[model samples]
Target chain A: MLYVELIAQGLIQGSIYALIALGLTLVYGLLRILHVAHAAFFTLGGYVGVVVANQTGSLAAAIVAAMIVAGLGGIVVFRLCYQPILHQPPFVPLIASIGLYIAAEELFRIVFGPSGLTYKYAFLQGEVELLGFLRFKTGELVVVFGSAAIIGVLSLLQTRTRIGVACQATVSDPQMAESFGISLSRVGDINFFVGSALAAFAGVMVSVLNNMVEPTMGSVPSYKALAIIVLGGLGSVRGTLVAALVLGVVESFGTIYLGHFLDRNAIAFAFLILVLMWRPQGLFARS
Target chain B: MLRLERFSCGYGLFRAVSELELEVPHGTITGLIGPNGAGKSSTLMCVAGHVNLLAGSIVFDELDIGGLPATERVRRGIAIAPEGRRLFKDLSVEDNLRVGGLIHPAGRFKADRDYVLSLFPRLGERLGSLAANLSGGEQQMLSIGRALMARPKLIMIDELSLGLMPKMVDLCYDALLRLKQDGMTILLVEQNTDRVLSVADHVCVLESGHAVWSGNAADARNDPTLAAAYLGLH
Candidate 1:
């Protein structure tokens, strides 16, 4: 019974990780830039959700508002921070991203205060019993099912749509895609918009689960997402998904069994190291 | 249909092609022939808006498209089957064509794809295969077919016979002739002087980014000096 409960919790957590990491992987795949500031978008989403939901008293409005703000913010960051330095070495944009992330975190702290904001009204407060013995929170169910639905639609869009095929072409070869009349700038805008929107959605869901919105909320998940992308194989979407779920389950188990010596987050890095040592190319990378 | 006036292009500082004037009239095949590093590919790439156009104007269909990006140029009916056949290796052959025809309405996709398949029927059988898995000749065919998907008025092909079986080469050249018959303009760059001389209506020989020789293909074949000096024929 404990094993099943842990598995359920891990899978729910994995869904959030997958949502956040998908955005990171997409941006990395297109521009080869590590968008560390993505976490800031995540943080921004939570604040937006909390404020909107509190004021308007509508969860849907909060989600939509958060997505729009974060999506547009992501595009602005790309234009201001990444575009000018794109011609430089990869490290230039990466350093800029790190700086931007730090600045965003500080800005949030200044604006939202250090203590963070909590939900004014109860959200999905009840728990439901599953099968014969297990009980799960309604918020947990929402996160898992909502994330799964979003990912399903995204996968279908990537495989079945014209723009989706165009995105893949651009990823495979930008110059050739350009020659074929697929604008790289347009693709970049779409990628940043969609990726950031997904991150924002994850943020809203996490806020609903915890009933709190904090400036530093994104820090742990952001670094963990970075680790997941590398563990999955850089620039590979499917690999990142698998890595996220695996990391979630490992961390879930490790938290209980190794609580005496290791922290919950430390287990993620340790597992990453072990997996990389065994399969350096990543779980799904074509070796 | 396509003209370059006092054109100069290259990388940031190093000039690969200098001031040059060339034209491809409507419904004709114009060949650009040169040795390696003579800027044959650069010239085509510049026209396709891939390289830096350092100076001068690229007038296509009486429109000066010197400042347009590659995607806009494709919209204006300029397409290139670039050297190296840079097909999207991970995409299926069908999806590659879809991307090529992305600017057109979705309703036009089937017709364009069918036209490409008609031109290279082998692509029909392998539409599901990843481009990286295709043979060298098939990749070349798909490259040309992908360009054709845009339904361009002028199609530029660079290094058309670089690494293909002779039979495949013949098939591609035949497709060019068929495209010509359909009133499509062609700008061909090739090291195969003999092949260019065999079919090109107008020939321009570039040396160190200058047009060292320009005339009808007949005149080029009959001139002993040009034949011996550049065509590798005595």
Candidate 2:
């Protein structure tokens, strides 16, 4: 049925949103920044993935290259921009991130042309039959599997590694973490790089699903992801996923039942206001 | 041996400890006793490389450790149980010890963890509980135990008796005595002058950021002039 297909599409979109939100939540949780340029990283990743795939003629190589570049971009941004403004007022970085976002968008437009480009990754096209009533596009399946894999690896890293332990400690108390000899700056760099890399991967997924990429394609997804992150909770990873899926399903059903005339932006804003009014801290804020 | 030569350390332009010349020979317990704002914690911070020195040199076993970071200092066998018992509150008591052992120059987690648990048997019973869930006395014990996991040659503790019941303080001091018996050199900073001096081999009194009196604990206890001059008490 069309309803099932719409649900499938929404779920795939939600997975990508969840990925972006995960990264955004992480950097915000650690550094307490809004990181308005996060969407810029997403768009950057899409363009990079396309260029890399065309150059290498391999999807895996393209995704990996996209991730590396985005990760490094995150590190560079932290080192060159965030580091200098660490002691300044909160608004300094917020305004600075806006500048960064604009700069990244302009750079992308200049490099890739203002017009959107079509993706030619043959492997990502076509559909597969699932159960009797369910079906999924190859890209949708990739979104499901790829996002899960990335989340799994990150969870393992967070719970097991020394760097991860140090990060958690730094989040708890930067001064105390420093006393233990953990470098807060290095942790910031790593968190930024890794988080942006995940967003970059989501960008790649979006490009594959839509069969096209644009300079400002990340704009809508980033906004939705940010909304999802807030709805879930500021720093709660599990909450991000749950909130993303719920939003995805709700939007899917809303579009079908209430007619396409119901603007998604309005719906999202209404939901955000309602939730914040009821629970200002989000659903599962870590206390 | 750890030696400080006219060491002055503080935050920014404000000096908390100045002209502090002291030494803790290997395998000895040294107490730094003073009233509030007398720079006992600053002196320990200087030795532990947590505070930047404004002037003078801190030499640990003949190495100028002024340029070293805190972890490097710990790697070189200088560990600190800082003021306020700053534990990783969200982490389990066992995980706290795990991270403490992570900075160890080399070791197996299970083995070193077991060793730390053995040293603080109370921690063994609460290994699964988060650090914040532990009582103040238990958290203090966990902090000290974490430092011990590093197997440092010199351990500097600040206000080990802070915010604890009198009985808990006795238990904490008993552990300090045991650490001494096991041949760990220590620098203890506290306002509990009588309590620290009673067990200390040597005692240094800091007043207005300068060493006002330095002598054997017996001498500090016996000399009325030095005692009154340092703390305005006998």
Candidate 3:
């Protein structure tokens, strides 16, 4: 029962990391930028969903509103912030993103509150039997299947659609993409929109899972997603997903076994350090 | 038709090409020949809106295009088979060609792809193969075929024969001639002065970003100084 609970928690949290990291992977893959403010989108999405769900009492409405709001926020951030510093220096855009992250956190504090907010979701509350001995929350199961569905849809978009092919082509060669009449600016904007929406979706899902939304909640997961992308290979979607799951499970098991001295974050970082020391090029990256 | 006057373009704080004037009229092949570091590639890139243009204007069909972005330039029927063959190495040959014709309707993919395959039949065999896996000659063929997919009014070929086998060069030149007969305007840059001069309607020789001579191909062939010094003619 303990093992089942631990594994289930790990998988649910890992799926959130995977979802958020997909956005990071897309931005990094195409624009070659880290986009730290992606966390802000996630955080904002949670807040938006919470407010809307509280008011409208409809999870569907809140989810739709949060995604749309976060998606637009992404486009705006790209145009106003990221685009200006695109060709400056390597760290220029990165620093800009970090600055945006800080500003967004402050903005959230001002708009919402500095404290955390919790939800009383009447739907899918409490735990149900998972095999014979193990019990799991209905919400956790929804998370597992829901995130999987999102990842599947995203993968299909990237692999099967023409626009997705264009995105891949742009990622490979920006100059060639432009020559072929595929606007790089347009691609950047579209990617920013998609990536931000994914981040927001993960934010809302994680908030619902925990039944708590905090302004600082976006940071740990966002940073963990970043670490996962680096560990999985920066631009490889498959790699990011695998690395996210591994980190989630490692953090989970470490928290369970390591006792009160070491936290999940510390365990995650220690694992990251070991992974970096072992495979600097990333575990699944191709040469 | 394409025209440039007093055009200077380069990387930041350093000009690669300067004060160039040339006009390529309809249905003609203009050979642009120069030695290494003569800004041949830079000039083409600037015209394609990739490099920084410091001064002057680019006129295509008498409309000023110097202010346009690369994709807008491509939309206005200008295409380039860039010097490095810059094919998306991860994508298959068919995918590369499909991207080339992206400005057009989706329904046109098959027809445009078929047209390119007809020009470079080798690409048809390697349609499913990644561009990185192709030989140098096949890559060059794919590059040119990819450009042809754009259905451009003017096609620019930079170093069309460079690093290509004689047979492959012959095939590419044959396709260029076919395109010319189909009423396409061509601007060809080449290290092979003999081949360029043989097929070119007019020739412009650039040395160190300056035009040393410009005339009909026959006239350039007849001039003693240009023939001996630039064209390697005795």
By lDDT, rank the candidates, best first.
Answer: 1, 3, 2
TM-score (chain A only) of candidate 3? 0.95
Look at candidate 2 and tell me the lDDT of residue A64.
94
lDDT score at residue A229, model 1, on the 0-100 scale: 92
TM-score of each: 0.96, 0.91, 0.95
Off by over 4 Å in 2: A1-10, A254-262, B224-234
Docking class of 1: high
Clashes of 3: 0
lDDT of 2 by residue, B90-166 (tens): 88897777667666543577787776666677889999999999999899989888888777899889998888888
TM-score of 1: 0.96
Q: In model 1, how large is the Cα lDDT of residue A97?
A: 92
Clashes of each: 0, 0, 0
DockQ of candidates 1 onward, in order? 0.87, 0.45, 0.77
lDDT of 1 by residue, B1-234 (tens): 999999999999989888888999999999999789899999999999989999988999999999999999999999899999999898899998998899899999999999888888889999999999998888999999999899898999999999999999998999899899888899999999999999999999998888889889999999999998877875
Residue B144, candidate 3: C-alpha displacement in angstroms: 1.6
Please report, as a residue range, the 10-residue window in candidate 2 chain B with the lowest summed lDDT.
Answer: B98-107
Candidate 3 residue lDDT tens string, A141-253: 87789889877887788666778778878988999899989988889888888888888888787788778888898888778888999999889888998998888888888
